[model samples]
Target: MGEVVFWTIIRTAIVLPLLWVLKSYLNVDLWWTVSIISVYGVIIHPAVIHYRLFNEKNEEIIEDTLCSTCEHFDKTAVLCLKHDEHPTRDYLPCDGIDWSPKSSDKSQNVFDE
Candidate 1:
């Protein structure tokens, strides 16, 4: 997720200035359309694609691993927040010893209370 967001920011940084430069040559109306499409195509679409690809690649870990149900598991980044590490289908950062839920953790105590 961070990688996806990082690259999207990079794409925006590259595209926005380039589009601003295009404003001088293109008419205002066409420039806006081009800018919109370019932003969507270069930044939004690629981010979406990257996210889908990341999800597809990590589907097994995200869905089947013990970390998947842990509180520290970050589904978007497939990371274990407790140890600040990425967990895989075959490995865990703390070997499940440090696994815990997020701070919002209302579900953690559902049965406890």
Candidate 2:
């Protein structure tokens, strides 16, 4: 996910300046159409593809692992926040001993009450 976002930012950085430069040479109607198409093809399409690939590659860790339900799990980065390590199906950063449930406002309220 981070990779997808980072690359999308790179593409946007490159595409926006080029589009700005081209606007001077093209007519309004033509430039608007081209800009929209180029933004989608160069920036949006690639980001979508990368995001899909990221999800495919991490599907197991995301869906089947204990870390997926843990409070320290970071689904976007596939990282364990507590151990600062990536979790896989066979390996857990803290070996289950440190696993904790996700904290929610409801749970906190119960404890507070």
For model 1, how does the per-residue alpha-carbon lDDT over 56-113 read when each residue is reduced to its tens digit?
A: 9999998888888787888888988788888887789898798666555656578578
Native-to-model Cα distance after best TM-score fit, residue 59 in candidate 1, in Å: 1.5
For each candidate, give its TM-score against the true structure. 0.83, 0.87
The 10 consecutive residues of candidate 1 with the worst lDDT sum are 99-108
Candidate with top lDDT is: 2
Output the TM-score of candidate 2. 0.87
* Position 92, candidate 2: lDDT: 97
Off by over 4 Å in 2: 104-113
lDDT of 2 by residue, 4-56 (tens): 99999999999999999999999999999999999999999999999999999
Output the lDDT of residue 12, model 1. 95
User: What is the alpha-carbon RMSD of candidate 2 to the true structure?
Assistant: 3.1
